[model samples]
Target: MQDPTATARPRKIIHIDMDAFYASVEQRDDPALRGRPVVVAWRGERSVVCAASYEARRFGVRSAMPAVRAERLCPQAVFVPPDFVRYKAVSRQVREIFLRHTELVEPLSLDEAYLDVTAPRSDLPTATAIAEAIRAQIRGETALTASAGVAPNKFLAKIASDWRKPDGLFVLRPHRVEAFLTPLPVERIPGVGKVMLSKLHAVGIRSVGELRQWPREELERLFGSFGGSLYRRARGIDERPVEPDQPVQSISSEDTFARDLPLHALDEAIARLAGKTWQATRRTERIGRTVVLKLKTAQFRTLTRSLTPDRPPASEEELRAIALALRDRVDLPADTLYRLVGVGVSGFRDREEAMTQPPLFE
Candidate 1:
């Protein structure tokens, strides 16, 4: 009983992501950190990794790894606590960079965003050119690197963006969509996580090429409501629109360290992280009612604590206190070490004056 007229046509989409966003920014600012294994997080028994430089990634040091474990893998790694405020300032600069290209922009996260540049400024002949120009501008303005993916739809475009990384560009022409997807693993499709992969494997569907071989009816019978979606995606069909001016949801800062520090330094680390979070709030000019602290241990265990303040803290000292208080709540073994720490503010409110107020007498 589906209406044929309701089917949507595909559109051009591009996804752009900063390369190793936080760590890259750190390296860009501090020349000494470049080409070194840099982990942007504090070292302790209750910390988590926020970002890992490519050099660090080579030693199996990944985001969310414990500071102790990361050190075990790469003993010489450098660990630094997060400074979110600076990252947010940089993100705002990146957003302004996007606006110059097209109005149809959808930010997936601070480090990544999607743009519908089918119709772009300056009458660029192709989306690829627009992507190139944007990347160049980012490098010029921020001294940072970004990767771009251009495709016929958002799904494909997002995957393509990560194909060539650390200041690279990849374009998937409409004609090459099927070829590009066929050899890719099913996991490349956004929602095909561990659970979905097992189901597909049980049915001998290991790759996009195999998934494409299933009859629509069989796929529908097996996956039920998700079958049609899977089938269409197998063929690179996506119809999502690029949305602009989505409301801000949260602001946060985190870092993964190269080495674990003693637990006693936790207070100093939290203070630095709090300052960073405050900067992000100022750049976005949004106040939040809730504050969150994230930690990852040396064994890669993750933990979070949050506090909803009666009113948002008006100063960095207040922010640090809330974060340090949350840190005390986490349970760490006497000898445990951490690899990362993060602070975030969410539940935003506007500063603008309201036109009407409720009557107090009522």
Candidate 2:
């Protein structure tokens, strides 16, 4: 039988990402901060960088790095606390610009989004033109730079968006997809993190071309379900549609301590984080059934423990209890030091569905 996928019309997807979003906003608001290194983060030993301007990045500063390390990297950098209210306003303005072209806008975060313009509402004759227009409009209105990528699908478009930094656009026609992906590193594929990259390297698959040569069965046997994704991605296949107004997948709050602490010393932190996560969940009508506890070791190893109780926690205290209890499930040695802890809830269901579902044991 012929492949059904090949019969479908080619999609036009665009990924738009703002450059140094939080830091750029800080600089845009304060003329004095425009040329200097700007780091958006709180002034605390335990704080992590929310965003770093390109000036700071030249000195090895980056988002999510420890604030202390960022200070060491760029001592003269200007540190400013994050202002979500202002950032959110800017994001909304940019998102309005996207909606003017296509209703199929999927926001990845406040700083980036995917737009499916297979049948754009605007008169722009091509996806690339649409991308150019959007980027121009964003720059004109927000006084902030944005990068855009246009391709036949979301995966390639996302990768293309990063090909050029701050105020750039790249287009990947369908005919050029294979050639464009061949020499790229395996880690360039989404979901291929450091551990997955190491595993791929172990199998002598260091590039997309190498990954494409492996038999599907062999890859599946070695990496389970993810191997199938690798097999498809190597060939530039991504069928996920741009889902607009996507529901919340999870809610979480995490903290990195000023200093690493033993596992036994995390009770207070877990409780505090869980409370924050609980407050976030209150905004949604859905119920989250799984409680998850995440830990990052001083050595950078990350692990998570989760429990799906028959009923979801009903209060902040209950969520805190579940999160704290999950620590017992960790199998790490007592001497292991952890630098971060997080609490989260996932496996969400509509309120009615959660209330009406039958028990699993029954």
Candidate 3:
């Protein structure tokens, strides 16, 4: 084996994505479900698609779509309630397989993770080999298949992972980054959601090559803070390392209404989101002092208001009250209709720092 540190070599990152994770699990456990369209969800107006087999996807049924719509799309689809306990167990077994290759495992969700195996404990000759080995191990141990992408950075690896999915492997060599990324649509870049996509389109920048033509300062002026990220990603430049444990920034919840509602109609929605945020925050030792309210108007503009209280909220009611009062911060017309509302807790401080702070009255 040659020395890894003896010369300059780009970081080797791999993104592993389990194919139709929950659906695959269901099919694995039930022999009858194999090669059949399956939709895992409850039967109700509020029930959403938890997962759909590739067979169901052919009928335009997908995860997160309404269960009613999923049924209409594929009437013959087998519906099953989700079994998260089994899914998590399988996820744990897959994670154990990752720990054998490298400690730099960053789990994005139960179904996906990023591994930095630039230096592998297994002394693998290259990242591609490690990806293959892990995929083989997962299929043998878990009775499932995963797609693997090997690249020099996380962004490229994530894209490459999806290039040939459902038991596929793709590699983006360091020398081929520019050639591979330049011709792709701007939407292929991370953070280019619908709103950002519209913004890019309005600017007459449809491809990454066109997006990269703009000066950084101009891009920043046009898109605010996200513009910097846009500029770098256009050229396949991502400096972020695959951190094992990403820090928690906030806990929040929001709901999109079936019909746009006036601001006065949001009281119940605010309370629901606040209660969820408060419950989620309880899982963290870090204390949050700021209460944030997020709203989106029917005109498609997003507005945010936040208040850092003298003390963190002590109960769900207090959090709800703070979130509800934030509606007054909206300076729009009284008749302004809103489509979404959210409540959150942020500005985190560890218990040690929170305990030592002087009282607000002081």
Candidate 4:
């Protein structure tokens, strides 16, 4: 018999990301918010934007910006708290749409994913077509829009997906990689953040094309192991495979309230999100060993607290209890208000292994 894996061709990878995911969901659910500047987050002293619609973005409102600052930037912007349960439901619907075309679906988050559709079920011959179909299906089914990018590899595909905004699709053909990357700023390269940009600027490397001219030895001297990787990416070379069964690294759920709620009312929000987190774990069917709580104050500062139980919680109630216990670690004033709350489960274990173990009480 022939080796089954040997005959497989190079994969065609596509990345799909929702446009202004939280804010878009809010707008889709409320017809009144359509075409308006929408910011999904609480409004108050400590609140920050969880997501901002394209309309809001025009005025410089952005995710993680203080709600007060966003309002100042776009006074007419409407603020809506995130409805995580609804978002998760829509995410699952999108995933199901992907499964209709290919089984090799790898979710990066609720709003983005990578799909290897080289061998799609439909007669779609190209990754671009697959992405288009997926985006269309998501829009038709949920009334929310998405953008997609198609390329020969994951790195380029992710970049392409962001090239256009709202309901756009971009395809980066293999031969055009270098031309596409050359003119962009060095900061556009993955892993090159503010600090890295300063370091690169010190060397007079300001753009992708400029980085390509640097001697390999010089890059290695400056960035160490990362320098070599950067050199390859600058030239649009990425050999990483499109892994179909990538392990689930983490599961989390967060919500932005319409108004900053008192600290005491957090229990209700946490309870609601804990159930959503449990449902997310069910989709992956992984047993998580740690529970975490995330909070963003109206002031825009973010905080997270986590706990590793002797063993993973077996029920949603148990998860909520653990998450609530972790919440006590936040040093909030008695009158302090919160704009957002989130719950997450991480450090997953195999389902079979988890089931075979003795019960918590036993």
Q: Which is the winner by lDDT between candidate 2 and candidate 4?
A: 2
Per-model lDDT:
0.83, 0.92, 0.89, 0.85
Error of 3 at 348 (Å): 2.1
If scored against the real structure, what TM-score would every candidate get?
0.67, 0.92, 0.84, 0.71
The digit string of per-residue lDDT tens for model 2 on 121-213 reads 999999999999999999999999999998878888999999998789999888788888889999999899989999999989999988989
**Considering summed lDDT, which 10 consecutive residues are worst modelled in model 4?**
1-10
2 versus 4: better TM-score goes to: 2
Candidate 1 C-alpha error for residue 68, in Å: 3.2
lDDT of 1: 0.83
Ranking by TM-score: 2, 3, 4, 1
Task: Specify the poorest-scoring 10-residue window by lDDT in model 1.
Answer: 353-362
Task: Give the TM-score comparing model 1 with the true structure, all chains together.
Answer: 0.67
Candidates, ranked, lDDT: 2, 3, 4, 1
Root-mean-square deviation of candidate 4 = 6.7
lDDT of 3 by residue, 87-180 (tens): 9999999999999999999999999999999888898898999999999999999999999999888988999999998899999987778778
Model 1 regions more than 4 Å off: 1-10, 216-226, 248-362
Best by TM-score: 2
Model 2 worst lDDT window (10 residues): 1-10
Q: Which candidate is the best by lDDT?
A: 2
Q: Return the lDDT, model 3, position 29.
A: 98
Task: Tell me the tens digit of each residue's lDDT in model 1 across 1-362.
Answer: 12111335446678999999999999999999999999998887556688899999999998877677887888899887899999999999999999998989898878999998877865778788889989999999999999999988788899999999878999998778878888999988988888889999999999999999998899999988788888888888777778898766788888766677545566777789899998888877656767888887877678888887656778888988988888887777767777778898876767441112221210
